[model samples]
Structures are given as structure tokens and as C-alpha cells.
Target: MTHWRKRYHFLVQITAFSLVLYSCDVTKPYANKQTVPDHLYGDAAADANANMAVLSWKEIFKDPLLQDLIAEGIENNLDLKTAAANLKAAEANFVQSKQAFLPSLSGNASAGAYHPSDAQASNTQVYQLYALSSWQADIWGKLRSTKRSMYASYLASEAYQQAVKTQLVANIAVTYYQLLAYDEQLNIVQQSLEVYSKDTETMKILKNSDVVTGAAVVQSAANYYAVKSTVPDIKNNIRQAENTMSLLLGRTPGPVKRDSLFNEQVYSELSTGLPVQLLANRPDVKQAELQLRSYFEQVNVAETSFYPALTITGQAGLYGTQLKNFFSAGAFLANIVGGLTQPIFNNGLNKQKLKIAQANYEASEYNYSKVLLTAGQEVSNALYQYQMVDEKAQSRQEQIANLEKAVHFTKELLKYTSDTNYTDVLTSEQSLLSARQSAITDKLQQLQAVVNLYAALGGGWK
Candidate 1:
């Protein structure tokens, strides 16, 4: 009895010690210590609360056909689907983690006959039935930390899904605009072909009248063929762009329907808002932050492992040699035991676990920082590109006007006098065509800039 009392006192002391440690709170709650500096968008950013990312994709990509394509991509894009699946899996893991705090119970029954080898020995029947339960006390908040970690992972998965969705919307819109630009370029090239044909005929008449040499006539024809040869390459580019959009929509390669580049309009004001808003807007940024939070909890879990674990196990059963007496009070048995385990030595495994967890948490912090910087870079680049393209619009039109006049003036000079030649006409005409094409490209750049900025601001997923 004295020995038993000593053992009981020892158990009480251990329990008291563990409870004291528990009161100290070995796990810390998650906190955001990350900071974002000023001027993430450089000097060009408009300091406003109204971010374009807050708008729905429909508001940004006002084109009806482009909106339809973005909708289709959200519904069918395989990467988005995969992200959704990952979210479901993370949710399941979080649910399972919550269940870890509950006790586990199991039941079992068995029957057997036992007999001696001697002939005179009588056979005996044995029967037993039992139920067992076990539970581990979370004296160090280990289970709580694990649950929080899983919840963070689930949130990260959700952010990942949204990131995929935003990217898909941007891809669909960008590719659709590219197709439009290609169509316009093709139209411009075809128009040039007709004009070149007329100029070639004019050159032939001039050569016949002795106004120009054979060299001039051949040069005019050669210029026409050169412009015509670009047709196939442009068509091929259009086909490839269509296929790219088709892939984004998770469909077979085919032609994509789109309005003319000049007809598409984005009415949303291009306000970039504050750079600090990236934490809430950018899905990838949010995901990285959540991942860091998860790792923080994991480190807490690892720290808890170095402490003691308390578990309780209980069993209740009925046993009897005879079936009729199995239910009697005399055959009833029950027992319960509480145990405490403290790791004394394990080849430094516990220390190793803590070190590994700490390293991972630190690594996640670095990765999170990198993601923030990248987000800022994207916002800055998109805004700068839009500004540059917007500024070039008036100059581009003026340049095209000048080139057009040059082409016309050169043609008349070749017909009237020897002051200019066919080479001069060809050069001006080519310059005019190039300027027109560049104008179309400038429009494309402006459209893509808006799309990219919207995406960079974490738009479209809402």
C-alpha cells in the first residue's frame, strides 16, 4: 500500500508539471508580421482605393465575345479544375484533423474450445466479449496546432484555385485580343496587295511610254510579291493563336470568334490602388502567406513533440467458461490506466524534427517575400506599358498620315518626271503599310496592358 501510494504521488506530480507547462501556452497564434514598402508601383501609381481588381471580369473585358470565352475557360479549364480538387482534398484533411481530438472506441468478441490431450480430460468452452477506448490528452496544444495548420492549408488551396481562375481569364482575354489584331493585320496586308497591283500596272504603262526603265517596272512587281508572301505566315500565326485559346478553354483546336480589334472597348478606369492591397487581391500572394501560416503552426506542433504526452486507455469485458454465466456480475471485468510518456533519448530524432520544422518555416517566409516582390513588379510593368502605348496613339496616326502622302506624291512624280523613281514609291508605300500595322499593334499592346494589370491586381476571380 505504501509503494502504491508513492506511485500515486509520482503520477500526481507529473500531471501537475504537465499542467503547469500547458498553462504557459507552448503554441502561439498566427500573426502577420510581413510589411510592404511604399512605391511598389513606382512613381506612376495612382494612390486610390478603387482598384481595377475589385471589378468583375465582365466590367473589364467589355467585349461580349471575349466575355463568353473567359466564362468558358473558368468552367472548363483543367488547371482550375485541378485546383478545386486540391481544395476538396485539403478540406478533407482538415476535417480529419478535427476528429483527432476525439477518443477512439472499438469492440470485439471471440469464442473457443479448449481440451487436454488426456482422454479423460473434459473439453471446456471459453467466451469473451470486450470494448476498448483510448484518448490522448492535448496537454501541450499539439492537436489544436495541427488543426490550425490543416485549416491554413485548406485556405491556401482555395487561394490557389482563385489564382488559377484569374490567370485563365487573363489568358482568354489576351489571346482573343491577339486574334483580333492578327485579323486586322491580315486585312491591311490584303488591301496593300490590291494597291500594289494597281501601282504595278501604272509602272508598266510608264515603262512603255519611256518615262521609266525596265528596272523600275520589275522593282514594282517584286515589291508586290514581297508583301503578298507575308500572307501565309500571318495566317499561320492566326491559326496558332486560335489553337492557344482553344487549349485555354479546354477544347479542340479551332477558329476563335472575335470582334475587330478597333471595336473592342474596356470601359473600366485603370486605377492601380495601393500596393498594400496586393496581400488581399493577389491569390498567389495570399496563398503564400497562408502557407507560411501553416508552416508556423507546424513548427508549433514540432515544439510540442519535445514535451510529455498523456494518454488514457480503458477496457470493459465479460468472460466465462460457461455461456449461461457470461452475463453474471462475477464474470464482469474492467480496467483503466493513465500513462505519461516523455522522450528521454531517440538518437536526436525529436531535435531533428524541431530543426526541420524551423527550417521549413523560415523557407516559407522567404518564398512569401519573393511572391510579394513579384506581384509588385508585375503591377509596375503593366502600368508602365499602358502609359507608353497610350501616349503613342496620336503620334502613330500622324506618322501614318505623313507616310500616306509620301507614297501618293512619289507615285505622281514617277509618272510626270525623272525626279523620283519606282524605288522611292515602293519605299514610301512599304513605310505606310508598316506604320498602319504598328498602329494596330499599339492598340493590341494597350488592350493587353489593361488585361495584365487587372490580373496583376488580383482581378477576375471575384
Candidate 2:
């Protein structure tokens, strides 16, 4: 057969094979068949339109100081910076993956001398320069599947970066609030310590008048020192909390200035959107979904490998013994070759790889489902915590008010009647002190609950 006719027949055969491979999709098509629960918060209907996570950090965190802190954390936090670097690397890899279907060209130059085996022949010199290129036809969408997998992985990395940013903002806010709470607790202890000091002095005077025994004086002094000792501990907690905030800011250990806990305000009511919204709002959940897509694409890629790989390679260049004739047509050498490689006997390597790919895909499926469940659980836990804290706040306030009245009434009654003793005064003071401390803790826990709920709802990452 003539060369031209042979080339035409090869082209027709390649075209037909390409069409056949493209038409048959052996890999199972991926579908998101995950079953979302009826409602995330166990409600009959979902508030699909209402979404709290959509609100920016500035909107949810009312304090300007915390807002500034969050902004700083987003920019300066080392974890965020690392995540950004990973995202950039993933983006570059994805871009590189896109060039898989494109031909790769390489150049080479060589100069060598061939020695004659017989003594009568002279050594000959040869020089050659060549450009070589190769390309694999993505007849079965193998390159496309690999590219898609990399793209999904890149998206997952980006979503993971957002998740890191969200966590950083929450950490900074929580740490800053804890500092404020510790400061308030310290103030309470200080004020109570002074009052106890005065009571101890009164006890001494009563002991000198024989109105109270030695045990009362000792007990009053002990109570005063107990509150006094808490002062240093609370102050230490405040300093440690400040250090933690500084760490979140990616700065050296230092003080974090902020508003008082009482002044720190968050959104009154959280608007959690539909359960489906978590797939979009929560970065972790979104990342898991993307990971599942990436692994699925990998399975497709692995499956495609079971078929023959069609590659076309070519090289053309000049070669000559004499430098003068190197560029002439007589020195030119050119060839193009097309080949198909089938893994007829690979010792089960391909099958093992396919099995691994399928297993990884199944693992990703489990991860995506687990992440969805975990998201719902987190939101539910935070919601219940916020509700419980809010419910107790009122009762806690009432307890504080009644305790204050009891302390005042007991102290006043002690001076007016003999039946009221030093023990009664000590007990009232102890109860009042405990209630006051608890009030500060209650405020702190309530604030922490709000912070947690906001974070669980995928807030602060916007």
C-alpha cells in the first residue's frame, strides 16, 4: 500500500476508535443522593429564607473592638496564612492539570564520536539537535476526569481556608470575652474583699466587748482572706486569656483591650436557615462535599486507565557529520509514531489501583455524610445551650437579688435582736458572696454560649 493511503486508513481507524471510547462511559455517574434530615433543629418546618451565617462578622459582633480583632485575625493569623498558601498551591496544581490534554515539547542537543572496532577504520564524529513532542488523546475522558478531580480538590482547599478563618475569628472573640469575664470576676472579688475586711474589723471590736467569741473573729478573717486569694487567681486568668487572644492575633503575648462583658452584645436572635443551607454555609461541610467529588473523579480516572492509552509521539531535527551541512535538507530527520498500550498483564496492579480508588471514593462518601451529621449536632447542641443559659439568666438574677436582701436583713436584725447570732451573719455573708460570684460566672457562660452558637451556625467567616 502507498504511504498516503496507509496514513488515511490509520486516521480513519483512530477516529472510529476515539468515537467508540468517547461514547462508552464505564464509570458510574456521581450523584448527590444524601438524605438530609427533616430538620436540623428537630423542627417540623425549616426557615429556608432566614440565615444567620450570611451576616458578616461586623453584623453579628456588635463590639467595634471585637470587629477590629476579627479583621486583624483574618489578615494576620498564621493558620490563615498557611491555608492561603495551600490554596495557592492547589490552584497552581489545578491549572497544571488543565494542560494534561496538551502536547509536551522537549529539546535536546548531542555531540558524539563513534570509534571503529577495526584498526583500519577512522573514528567518525556526529552531531544532532532535535525537538521531541508527545501527546495522549483523552479519548475516554481520562484527562478530563483528572483535571476535574484537581479542580474539586482546589475548591476543597479554598473552603478549608475559609473554615480556618472562621475558627480564628471565633477563637479571638471567645478569648477576648473570657478576658472581660475574668476582669469582672476580679472586680467582684476585690469589692467583696473590702467588705469582708470591714466585717472582720467589726468582729474584733465585738470580741473586745465580749459580743462575739474568738471563733467568730477567726472565721471572719478567714473569709476575708479567701476572697483576697481569689483576686490573684482571677487576675492570672485575665492575663492568660489576653495571651490567648494575642496568640490568635498572631502576635506576641500582650493585653487585648476590649469592652466589658456586660457591654459585649451579639445578635439577639439567630436565624438559622434550612438544613440544606448548611451544605453551603458551613465551610467544613462544603469542603467535605468537594472532597467527595474529587475522589469520585479519581475513581473515574482510575477506571479509564483500564482501557488502552493512545499516545502520539514525534521528533524532527538536523544531523550531520559536517557542521557546514547541518542545516541542509540532506541532514534532516523526521518521524511521527502513534501507539496503543494495553495492560494485558500487569500482575493485578491496575485492579488493585481501581480497588483503592473505589475504596477512597467510599471513604469520601462516609466523610461527607458524617460531616453533615456533625454539623447538625453542633448546631443543635449550641442552640440548646443558648436556650438553657438564657433561661437560667433570669432565675440567677432573681437569686442574686434575694440573697442581697437576705444579707442586709440578717445584718440589720443582728443589731436589733439577741436571737440573731454571729453564725447567722457569717452564713448570710457567705451566701451573698457565692451568689455574686455565680452571677459573674452566669454572665460569662451565657456569653460563651452565644459565641458557640454563632460559630456553630457558621458565622464570622463571611
Candidate 3:
């Protein structure tokens, strides 16, 4: 028996040696692949630190109402809640992965009775109690790499949660602002309708007194009806906007109370810190980078699988035929085992798995790059939109001023001249009303552009 044991040991050593040689031939497909660039913004020519994005949510949105809504969204929004739960789940997985590197200990106990039915046979009772332990020696760094991969995944989930929070805050703010803008537009339309109705009444009196023709009265009445028709449509829009805001707040559709749109203050000078800081500041970008890092660790784990895994196991137990004898020292039993397993053949499954891991790693790298590029594009687009809206607001404000003057002058001219064509008056009124509505829309655009810019720069949810 001793000679046979020695021969078995020798064979095990030879097998281990052969596995090491085989491992030397196995290599990762992405082992030589270069890491993806950390920054995709192409704006790296500036001061390395100058492009960093920074804006606390409080500072970015100074409005108390908006800040309150954002806070509510963080607390109650279902998407954000799901994201938080996912982060917790990832953290739990990371803990389990880390535990793989430690030894596992367990205890066991058993009690039973046995009896024999024969001439001169006697009944026997036995009891047993013991403990067991096992641990894998991660000499190949497989467990360490797996734990690190899980840690990276945990961090990625956290980043994803942050990204969700950022989006939630931005969406709530934008929707709330939209509702306010609709309110302002509705008010403007109502006021325009009131003015037109009064003008229609005055034109009717003039026609009855023969100061204006029946055709003039009809034109003025048509203008009044046109302005009045817009009121119900604007009201419907306002209600829809309110419903949208309610849904974003994670509540049933209902009324949304807000401050006047004109009263809302938006920052005039939007200083977008820099482009290079997006990698660290943008939650989506950070999430992608973490996913890439996780994949990198996965590649290491895959490479380590080509090497042999050493595991040690032990089992100790106490057994007794009599239940009360389970605690007795005579009932104690124990065992210990150690093994080294190296993949010899599995129908090419291991190799295929490695290839799949390599493909996933490459895909993660591409996704990271894509995320960075998309973030940069969004920031650039938002900045340009903010600038365009800022310019448009200025131009529209001037246009509104001119239209106001035209309305006043046309009204005055109508009062002084008996031959003043009511058609001309109606034309001027409609143009002025159109210009005023455009100005209100431009104001909303300017505000929304600010919201978009802040979101793109990853400024909110800080």
C-alpha cells in the first residue's frame, strides 16, 4: 500500500508539472490589447484641470421650488429607487466574491440506532459530532481577480444610481419649468382675448353709428373669435404639462402649482467649466469606465482559469446510535482531503468561455468609448443651444417691444381717422399677438436650454 501511495504521489506531481507547461501556452486574446483612451472629448488641448465640470445641484438650481422638486424625486422616483436597489445587490455580490478567498468552516452531528435480528445478535447504538473546514489556495490569483471584478461591478452600479439621480433631477426641473411656461402662455392668450373682445365691441358700436362699415365690424369680430379660440387649446396644453410634471414627480397626474414663468430667474452667464472633466464628472461616463475596469479584471480571471486550482477540504462529525451519546468523545469522527484540478478536456468549452470573455471585454471598451463620445456631444449641443436661445431671447424681446409700439400706434391712428381701415387694424393686432407669443416661447426655450446645459455638463445631483 505504501509503494502504491508513493506511485500515486509521483503521478500527481507529473500531472501538476504538465499543467504548468500547458498553462504557459494558453494566453488571453486581449492580453496584448491596448487600453481605451480615458478621455474622448478631443478638447484636451486646454489646461488639464480647466475642463473639469462642477456645479452643486443647489447652486445650479437656485429656485426653492425646483430644488424641492428635485429632492422629492430623489426620494420617491421609482427609477431612482430601482437604481439604489441594484447598487445594494451589487454590493452584496461583491461581498460574496470577497468571501471566496477565505476558508469555510462548518460543524456536523448525527445520532442513530441499529439492531440485528439473529441468534446471539445484540443491538448497538452510536452517536457522532465533529467539525469540517475547506479553503482554496488562490496561487493563480483567480479568486483575487474575481473579487476585484465584483468590486468594480459594485462601483459601476453606484455610478449608474448616480446617473439615474442626475437624470431624475433634471427631468423634474425641466418638466416643472415647462408647466410654468405653459401657464405663462395661457395667461398671455387670455389677456390677448380680452383685448380683442373689447376691440370687437368698440368696432360693433362704430358700425351701428355709421362711423365704420359692417365689413369692418365683421373683421374685428373674426379677430376676437380667433384669439378666443386659442384660450381653450392653451388651457388643454397647460393641463397636459401639469400631468407630465406630476408623473415625473412619481405621483398620479394632478394639478401642479408653480411660480410665474416670468418670475423665474435663470443664470444669464452659463460658464461651462471645461470638457476634459467629463470623464470623472459625468455619471454615465464613470459607470462605463467602471464597467470597463470590471471587464479588465474578468480578463485576468479568465486567464487564470487556464492554470490548476488547488482546493483543501476537511470534514469532521460526531455520530451515535443513541441520541444522548452524540456529545461523547468516542462518537467523534473527522476527515481531510486536498485536491488539484486542471482542465484536461471539456469539449472545447473552457477555450470557448475564454474567447467569450475576451469578446465581452472588447465590447465593454467600445461601449466606454461610445459613452464618452455621447456625453461630449450632448454637452456641446447643449452649450450651443444655450447660446442660440440666449441670442434669440434678446432678439425676441426687441421684437416684442416693436410690436407693442405698433399696436399702440395702430390703435391711436384708428381713433383719429374716420377712413382708417379696420382690416389694417386687425392685421396689426394679429402680427403683434404672434410676435408676443413668439417672445414667450423664446423665453421658455432659453430656460430649457439652461436646464439642458446643466444636465449635459453633469452639474446637477452633486
Q: Write the per-residue lDDT of candidate 3 for residues 1-462, one digit (tens) a residue.
A: 696587567657654654464344333332323333444334422244433247677776778888887877777888988998999999999999989977899776565567878874598875656778887777676777788789989999998988887888788888887878778777877888889888889888877877778888788888888778887887888788878777777899888667888888887656655555666678888888888878877878877777787776777677667776667776666555667799888798778877888899899988977886787677667766767777777778777788788777877777778666787778778887888777777777778877776777676757
Tell me which of candidates 1 and 2 scores higher on lDDT: 1
lDDT, candidate 1, at 236: 97
State how far residue 181 of model 3 sits from its true place (Å).
0.8
- Positional deviation of 128 in candidate 2, in angstroms? 1.0
Whose TM-score is greatest here? 2
Q: Give the C-alpha miss distance for residue 108 in model 2, angstroms.
A: 1.3
Looking at candidate 2, the ten consecutive residues that score lowest on lDDT are 38-47
Kindly report which residue pairs in candidate 1 clash with one another: none
Best by lDDT: 1
For each candidate, what TM-score against the reference?
0.93, 0.94, 0.85
lDDT tens readout by residue for model 2, 206-312: 77887778998998899888778787788788888888888888899987878887886746767778888888888998899999999999999888878988887
Off by over 4 Å in 3: 1-53, 116-123, 319-332, 415-420
lDDT value for model 1: 0.89
Better TM-score candidate (1, 2): 2
Alpha-carbon local distance difference test for all models: 0.89, 0.82, 0.75
CA shift of 116, model 3, Å: 5.0
